[model samples]
Target: MYDYLVVGSGLFGAVFAHEAMQAGKTVLVLERRDHVGGNVYCETKDGIHIHKYGAHIFHTSYEDIWNYVNQFVKFNNFINSPVAYYQGHLYNLPFNMNTFRELWDIVTPAQAEAIIAVQRRSITGTPKNLEEQAISLVGTDIYMKLIKGYTEKQWGRSCSELPAFIIKRLPVRYTFDNNYFNDRYQGIPIGGYNKLIEALLAGVEVRTGVDYLKERALYRNVAKTIVYTGSIDEYFDYKLGQLEYRGLHFETERLEEVNHQGVAVVNYTERDVPYTRIIEHKHFESGTQPVTYITREYPAEWKRGEEAYYPVNSEQNQRLYQQYAILGRQEQNVIFGGRLAEYKYYDMDDVIKSALECVHKRL
Candidate 1:
C-alpha cells in the first residue's frame, strides 16, 4: 500500500507528497482536472503563458517561505501593481498618494489625509455593513470609485448587504508607491506555475483526470493514509449542508497587436460593467510577442458541482464548516489541507507553508 494518497495535485498536496517521497515513503497523487497544477495551471498560447484560472501573483513576507519555493524553480521580479478603471479614469491601486493625486489633484500626503479625513466624517459611530466600513477606512470617494463596484461584482452581492467585518481594514498608503502587496517578496514563477508544480511532483507518481471521490472504492484501500485536498463538506458527503463560494468566469481572447492593456491586471470598477477585471497574460511575464492574450474575468454565484473560487466566510457558512470540521476530525486516516479542504482563502505562499507544516507534523 502507498504511504499517502494525495487527492489533489495543488500546491499543498504536491508539497506534502514531495516531502513524503523525500523521506522515503510511497506517495500517489490524484488530480480531478485533466492537468496536475490545479487552479494554478497555465495554458500557453503562442509563447505566452495564460493564467487559465486568473492572475495569481505570489507575495509573502516570510523569508523561509520565499527560500523554500525558490528550491524548485526560478522566479522573476514581477511586482504586482494593479490599476483600477472607474468612470473613464485610471487610478493606482491600494489607495496611495498617486491615486489621491489623480482623484483630487493633491500632491502631498497631508493634503490626501485631510481630504480622506473629511470624507470619512460622513460615517460616525459603529459601522453596520461593508459600505460604511470601507468609507470609514478610506473615505467615500475611494470606496465609491475603487472599492464598491469591484467588491460588489466580486461577491455577487451589494456592498450594503455584506457584513462590515468583510472590509475590516482598507490600507491607505501615503507614498506614491503603487505596489499592491505589502509583502517583501513578490513575483510569479519564471516559466509559469506549472514548472513549480512539475518540479514538486518530479519523483512522485501522479494520475491526472482522476476523480477520487467518484472512484473511491478502487483507490481507498490502496493507500495507508489519505491526504484529501478537496472540499471538506464534500468529504463528509455534505451531510452538514454545503458551504457557499464566489465563482469566476474567464473569457480569453487573442489579439494581433501586442500589449492590449498597459499592465498585467486592470480592475474595471464600474457597476454597469459585468466583468470585474481584465488580465493581460503577456504582461505577467513582460512578453514581447507579436500578439497578446487577455482574459476578462467575471464573478458569478457558485453553485453545487461548479468550481468553487473564493469561500463565502459568512457566519452561517462558518457554522456549517465547523460542523464538517468535527466530522473531519473523526476520519480514520484522512488528513484535510489546502484552501478547499479547509474552507478558507489561501495565497500561494500560505498554502505552500501549510503543506510544509503538514509534512513536518504528520509525516
Candidate 2:
C-alpha cells in the first residue's frame, strides 16, 4: 500500500508527490491526461517546441520558488513582453510611456501626463463596472483602444457586466520599459516543462491515462491519504452543481519558414477577431532554424467533460465554488489543490509557491 495517492500529475500533484516521497513515503501519481505537466505541456515538431495549451512564461519574485524550479532544468532568459493590437494599431503592453507615445504621438512625459489627467477627469466617482474601472485607471483613450474589446471578448461578456473588482488597477508606467511582469525571476525552462515535471517525479511511481475516479475505490483502499488535484466538483460528482470555467481551443500549424510572428505572443485586442491571441513557438526558444510552428488560441465554452482552462471567477461562479469548498473540507483524507481543484486561475509561480507552502504544512 502506498502512503500517498496523488490524483492528476500536474504541477501540484507532481510537486506534492515528490515532497511526500522525500519524506520517506511511497507515492503513486495518477493523471487523467495521457501525458504529464498539465497545461504546461509542450509538443515538439520539426525541432520546434510548441506550447500545446498556451504560451506559459514562468515569472516569480519568490527566490525560494525560483530556486525550487531551477533544481529540475536550466531556464533561459525569456522575459515576457506581450504586444497589444487594436484597430490595426500596435502598442507596447503594460501601459508604458512608449505605449503612450504610440497611442497619442506625444513626445514628452509631461504631455503624456497632461493627456491622462484630462482623460481621468472625464470620469468621476467609484467605478461600478470594469469599463469605468479601466477608464479611471488608464484613461478613456487607452481603455477604449486596448482594454475594452479584449476584455469583453475574453470574458464573453460586456465590460459593464463585469465587476469593477476584476480590474482593481491597470498598471501604467511613465517609463519606456515594456517588460510584462515586474517579477525578479522570469524565464522558460531550457528544454520544456515536461522535462521539468519528469525531473520532479523521477523516483515516484506515475500512471498516466488513468482516471482516478474510475478506479476510486481500488486506489483509495491501497493509499493512506489522497492528494487530489482534479476538479473538486468532479470528485463529489457535481452534487452542489458545476463550477464555471472559460475553455480554449487551439489551432496549431507547422510552417517551413524559420519565423512567423516576430514575438512569442501577440494579443489581438480587436473585438472582431475571433481568437484572443496567436503564439509563435520558436520565438520562446530564441530558435534559429528552417522550420517554425504557431498556434491560434480561440476561446470556447466549458462543458462538463471538456478541459477547463480558466475559472470564470464571477460572483455567481465564486458562490458556487464556495459550496464545493465546503464539501471538500468534509473529505477526511482528501486534499484539493491546483487551479482546477480550487476553481481559481493561477500563474506558474503562484502554483509553485502554493505547492511549496502546502508541502511545508501537510508533509
Candidate 3:
C-alpha cells in the first residue's frame, strides 16, 4: 500500500506528495482533469503559454515561499500593471497617483487627495453596501468609472445589492506606482507553470482523468492516508448544502499579429462590456513569437457539476462550510487542504506554504 493517496494533482497535492516522497514515503496522485497544475495550467500555442484558467501572476512577500518555488522552476520578472478601459479613456489600476492624474488631470498627490476628499463627502456614517463602501474608500469618480462596473459584472449583482465588506478597502496609492501587489517577489514561471508541476511530480506516480470521488472504494484502502484538495461540500456528498462559487469562462483567440492590446492585461470596466478583462498571453512571458494569443474572461454564475473558481464567502456559505469542517475533522486518515477544500481563496504562494506545512506535520 502507498503511504499517501493524494486525491488531486494540483499545487497542494503535488507539494505534499513531493515532500512525503523526500521523507521516504510512497505517494500516488490522482487528477480529475486531463492535465495537472489545477488552475495554474497553461496551454501552449506558437511558443506562448496561454493561461488556461485565467491570468495567475504569482506574487508573495514570504521569502521562503518564493525560494521554495524557484527550486522547482525559474520565474520571470513580470510585474502586474493591468490597465483599466472605461468608455474611451484608459487609466492605471490600483487607484494610484497615475490613475488620479489620468482621471482629474492632476499631477500632485495633494491635489488628488483633495479631489477624492471632496467626492467622498457625499457619503457619511457607516457605508451600507459595496457602492457606498467603495465611494467611501476611493471617492465617487473612481468608484463609478473603475470599481462599479467591473465589480458588478464580476459578482453578477449590483454594487448596491452586495455587502459593504465585499470591498473592505480599495488600494489607494499616493505614488505613481502601477504595481498591483506590494509583495517582495512577483512573477510568472519562466517556462510556464507546467514546468513547476512536472518538477514537483517528477518521480511520483500520477494518474490523470481519474475521479477519486467516484472510485472512492477502489482507492480508499489503497493507502494509509488521503490528501484531499477538492471541494469540501462535494466530498461529503453535499449532505449539508451546496457552497456557492463565482465561476469564470475564458474565450481565448490566437491572433496573427505580434501584439494586440500592447500589455498583458486590460480590464474593460464598462458594464456594457460583458467580459471583465482581456489577457494577452505573450506579454506574460515577453515572447518573441510571430503570433500572439488573447483571452476574454467573463465572470459566470456557478452551478453544480460545473468548474468552480472563486468561492463565494457569503454568510450562509461560510456557515455551511463550518458544518463540512466539522465532518472533515471527524473523518480519520483524511486531510483536506487548498482553496476548495477549505472553502477559502488562497494565493499561489500561500497554497504552497500550506502544503509544506501539512507535510511537516505529517512527516
lDDT of 1 by residue, 236-320 (tens): 7888788898899999999998878899999999999999999999888889999999999999998878898889978889889
Query: Compared with the true structure, what per-residue lDDT tens digits does model 2 show for residues 186-305?
Result: 999998788899999999999999999988877777788898888888889988888888889999988888787788888998888999898988888799979888899998888988
Error of 3 at 178 (Å): 1.0
**Which 10 consecutive positions of candidate 2 have the poorest summed lDDT?**
216-225
Candidate 3: 10-residue stretch with minimal lDDT: 310-319
How far residue 4's Cα lies from its native spot in candidate 1, in Å, is 0.1
Task: Give residue 136's error in model 1 in angstroms.
Answer: 0.7
Q: Compared to the true structure, candidate 2 yields what TM-score?
A: 0.97
Q: Estimate each model's TM-score.
A: 0.99, 0.97, 0.99
Worst 10 residues of 1 by lDDT: 233-242
**lDDT winner, 1 or 3:** 3
lDDT of each: 0.93, 0.88, 0.93
TM-score of 3: 0.99
- Model 3: per-residue Cα lDDT over 280-358, one tens digit each: 9999999989899999999999998888998886777888999999999999999999999999889988999999999
Candidate 1 colliding pairs: none
